[model samples]
Target chain A: MHPLDEALQMQQQDPGLYTAATHPGYANAVGPFGGITAAQLLQAALLHPQRLGEPISQTVHFAAPVNEGEFVINAQPVRTNRSTQHWLIQASQDGHMVAMATAVFAKRRDTWSGVDATFPHNLPDPQSVAPMQWQKRPEFTNRYDLRYFDGVIPHELSGQERPHGQSSLWVRDEPPRPLDFAALASICDVFFPRIMIRRQRWVMIGTITLTSYFHADSALLTQVGSDYVLGVARAQVYRDGYFDQSAEVWSAKGDLLATTHQMVYFKD
Target chain B: MHPLDEALQMQQQDPGLYTAATHPGYANAVGPFGGITAAQLLQAALLHPQRLGEPISQTVHFAAPVNEGEFVINAQPVRTNRSTQHWLIQASQDGHMVAMATAVFAKRRDTWSGVDATFPHNLPDPQSVAPMQWQKRPEFTNRYDLRYFDGVIPHELSGQERPHGQSSLWVRDEPPRPLDFAALASICDVFFPRIMIRRQRWVMIGTITLTSYFHADSALLTQVGSDYVLGVARAQVYRDGYFDQSAEVWSAKGDLLATTHQMVYFKD
Candidate 1:
């Protein structure tokens, strides 16, 4: 199994009880990459027998740092309607909750389709851009291949302050695995916090809450395969020690896959 | 008390348990207005004795239609950290769960602050713009004082079809009450579904999931008083009968107060 697959793997102890071991390959500064945990939480729901459909929207709240070890996850399908299902999932270690999430799933049907946001233009192809190399960064950073089209990389700060927080990049799995919902969820967090890019310095930052809306289905994701996807992220406001970031994930063929928003806690 | 206040008012039945009555003043096509329900869910969390600081992010899932009558809300502070708190709130009518929500609160400290989005300019003052009058629309329409700056209002659609889903308007409580978290949460849903505006047709539409990030504190809200706030909303994509809408609420002085996103279910 791929390291990511192994990292997100869970053993079903009971119908609603799951046990997952933390993997070092996806480790962040404090714990496992939040994106992996998010995917695990969604995985629990997807594996449930009563799961209704594909995920339409999901919100994950990081209550406490997830320490390395075996953790328990409990997912409950709170409500299942004719066309939709609501789920509440939580992960805990030693009886203390570390993360919680809420997800909504629905069986989609064909209808009028349109895209309002314009596809970004004039960007170097993924093949032309060289992948960033950072040996001492978080272990999680090593799991993805990131090629920046704009914004400064963390260690190479120019000391030139920026007036805005924005970054555009091409990203994909390091091992080039086929794209899926779990991988897409993890990619949503691939962009380093926008503050790091704008201030030209690395600071202590953590995502407090994240919400993502899926715009594509399995067929689209399968078509994306192992190719790099364009990612664009920017911060709308930074105030009272918390900043909100909004991001978009687009396919190489110009398909909008997902859009995510989160509020992050930062310290100077 | 204004009708809005009455519509959102909840009676404490016990610790973590509250009862709220549905009022016709906020009635939708099939149930109470979703905005009112969102406000009530936040109210339950705010009233919790174990609650922490201000709300930073909230996501509410409308699993089932909230029937008109009395409903019970159970709010639980699932995890409480030193600086942040996570909450799970659910509403049930009889024995069926109608809605579920998750919220994150934190004790904020002063930090570097900046607004990336510009305050919308070149719009007429709220007073100069006439309120939209729709006698046959959902009863909830009367609860807000909306002055359109662009886009065709339902029932008065122009023959011209819009290629994009976008709406800009000024909104205030019908009775002009000072803003608070609950009131602000409700105002985020004031914009009609973007699909209706883009297609220039009133189709069956409902919000499946809504998430909002609060950018303002109570002190700022108080300073703004009862003045109208500008609201700009647009759809990113409409596919498979579902479209995602994103919006921003800005004060008269151009401060971004909150940003909201929602996925809606639409029929042709």
Candidate 2:
């Protein structure tokens, strides 16, 4: 099995309850990669027997970091409408809350459609861009292939103005797994902290909350199967002790796959 | 007292519980304005004695339409760190979930800061723009003084290609209320549905999930007190009965006050 799929694997204990363990391959400095945790939490909802349709929006709040080993997920369908459903999911370790999330799923119908936000232009093909080579990389970083167009990691704290904190990159699973909602959810958080790009120095930082809006349907994902997707992320403003990051993920063919935003806590 | 304040008023029942009524002044077709509900949900956290600081991010899901009259809000702080806190807020009517939200609050401190996203450029001052006049407006529309610079409502559904679904306007309370987090939260949703602007037609539409990242602090809000803030909203894509709207709220002085995004359900 692919590492991501293996890491996200779960056993259902009840209708909306499941148990899973953290994958050592995806370990970060803390518990596990936040994206993996996010994927696992969202997987609980996708696996629910009462799920109405594919997820269109999901928001996850990381209240506490997870520990190694087993954890429990409680996915509850708070409301189910004729064509839409809402879920409230929580992950806990030792009966203590570690993360919470809310998701929206719907049975989509044909509609008048168009894209108002344009895809990034003037970028080289993914195959031509050199892949990122990290020094002292985390286990999770090894799970994917990353190629940067801009905002590469600095060798040392520049201590100079690094204006326009933006990173655009092409990314795909290391073992080349087909694109899926779970994989897409995990990919949304792949960008390193914007602060690291902006200040060129590592600071104590963690994502407090992250929200992702998936635009691609099953057909779209299948079309992007086992291919690199372009991701662009930038920080709007860094104020006080919190900052917000806005990101867009696009398929190689220029289809917008997902848009995500998160609020991070930092201590300088 | 301001109608917005009156509409968001609540009576505390417990440490994490409060009761509030929907204000008719802000009623839409089926329920009170979603922005008001979002503000009330955030207010629940703001009012909690245990809350550590101001909110930096909030996500609210409209599980069901809230009816007129009283609703119960449960705002519990699931986790609290030294400088950051996480909250789970839910609004219910008759023991059924009507809305669910999560919030992150932090005690902001002075930090290295800058804005990467540019504010909209080249527009007449609010005083020069004519206020929007509605022939048949919702009650909530009357609560604001809106002056549009672009993407005004078309006299009729053109049925032609309405490209670039965007709206830029200057808006504030009709009677002019001072800017605050609650009022700012309400302002985030002031833009008429993007579909109405895109397709140039009235469609069956409702927001399923809305997320707002507050960028300005109390000090900044005070500086822009009662002034018309510029709001620019645009749709990224509309697909399969669902679409996403992205918006940025700016102070008259070009300060980005907040950025908001929402997924709306639409029927063609």
Candidate 3:
């Protein structure tokens, strides 16, 4: 069975209040390093909003240490205001709040507007580049349906290690569903645990903290025009085995859709 | 004349496209030590929306290079959708984008629906703590209407060292305005810069980056409470006197109004 299927099976009782996935990497045998990847848990949370799968804004707090193990994720809608909706997701290990998140999603609308700056008219369209076909083991793959528009990985990640910056790839909903702004709010932190250290690979030490702010249209499944600016991502500081970075995920052309910031534990 | 007047005076005739701000200190600043101080400029940005009197969600980028000088700020309202309004503020020096911000704001409403569980509780009442009185300063004195609710400065900027965790203050719109959401978005980067110092006394290093998100709500200025929860904030990582940190600012009633993550320069 697929790992996601197994995880779903464990949750067959369907305690829709939370996810019943047993992520392997976060098992106790691995110590703190074993904690379920934030990405895995975040994916589960984002999937919860598949019904209204529009992207929103999310802020996460690392309340305590998380060790790899069988974990449960609890998520539910908090407040549905006039223009925005808020959801709270908590990931627990052995009944402790390891990581917690708050997501704010905006409602759908037909129109949006912003400044029309000169987009790097020079940069090639993400489509013009060769498709990035990176396959993840079933354990990690179930979490994301990632598509790479910028075909080339940054040189720093290219085995050629240097204090260089990073790049952007087009990402979207997996299993294809319409999601709202709230969903986007949660995934913005998906890349931070892996920022910098491109040439060298490091299993996510863990997400010390992940947070994001959502802007633009809430409908991610549709509403294309690149009203958002080109995605500009970079790692500002990575030292002493810890890194802090931020990324601007632009709309297709060059409107600013969302901005994300993260601090990751680089256990090198 | 107000320091703000000193700052915004000349009103350079340039159409005003945002540009990046540069500073002196770094892993490699020719001068033994120099850096950017972002909180002040950030506070300045908060006043803009209030100036225009618009309510908006806030998304700020700490741009690649740290901003070092007195730059200009231009807030362009992107789309005033029926129910929502969006704007992008660009901070620039000569003609480069120093930092850009995109924010969303909603029309104020008196009531909304929320899960009872989401109702903020378990927070101290604002009346419980004595309002902190700040000694006047020639520069920042009246510029900001700062009311220290939870943690009091007790003393002037004598540069004394104390605790290490996050600090909280009650920040509201000055000059008697309706403390709009955009105003809070501006100051979100305010208190976070000083969390790094083992001692309170430190000089201006530049801020590498700042990313902020809007939270559920804090009581409007009228319902203002006491006891601010500095919430969870930390110097996630610091190297060569440069560090980045994230903070969640909560109101006395436990309402998480706004959260901020900033990369500021700190030195011994």
Q: List the pairs of residues colliding in candidate 2.
A: none
| Candidate 3 C-alpha lDDT tens digits along A3-95 | 333433334124325545554522332333212334444455556643243334455555455554466677655444444344556677787
* Residue A231's lDDT in candidate 3: 50
Where model 3 places Cα greater than 4 Å from the true spot, the runs are: A1-16, A23-55, A62-70, A76-87, A106-112, A115-119, A125-163, A171-187, A190-205, A216-220, A224-231, A239-241, A253-255, B1-268
Candidate 1, residue B89: the lDDT equals 94
Residue A66's lDDT in candidate 1: 93
Candidates ranked by DockQ: 1, 2, 3
TM for candidate 2 is: 0.97
Using TM-score as the measure, name the better of candidate 2 and candidate 3.
2
Q: Candidate 2 chain A: minimum summed lDDT over ten consecutive residues — where?
A: A152-161
Native contacts conserved, per model: 0.85, 0.89, 0.00
User: What DockQ results for candidate 3?
Assistant: 0.02
Interface RMSD of 1: 0.9
Candidate 2 residues A128-245, lDDT tens each?
Answer: 9888865557889889898987997754556565877799999999989999999999999999889888887777788889999999988899999999999999998778777889
- Please give, for residues B1-268, the per-residue lDDT of candidate 1 as tens digits: 9887787688888877999878899998989888898898998999988889999888999989888899999999999888888999999999899999899888988887877777777889788888876535788888898888787465576635688888889999987899999989999888888887888866788898999999998889998789999999999988897889999999998889999999999886
lDDT of 2 at A205: 84
Task: Please provide, for model 3 over B1-268, each residue's C-alpha lDDT reduced to its tens digit, 9 standing for 90 to 100.
Answer: 4322233233333332322222221112321111122322333444444333333234444443434454666655444444334444556556654454444434433321111112234544444544445443323323345555434445545565544534545443334343334334544554524542334433445553455555443344335432233344444333333344556655555545555665444444
The DockQ for candidate 1, computed on C-alphas, is 0.85
- Note the DockQ of each predicted structure: 0.85, 0.83, 0.02
Docking outcome class, model 3 = incorrect
Given candidate 2, what's the lDDT at residue A109?
Answer: 85
Runs in model 1 lying further than 4 Å from the true structure? A133-136, B134-136, B158-160
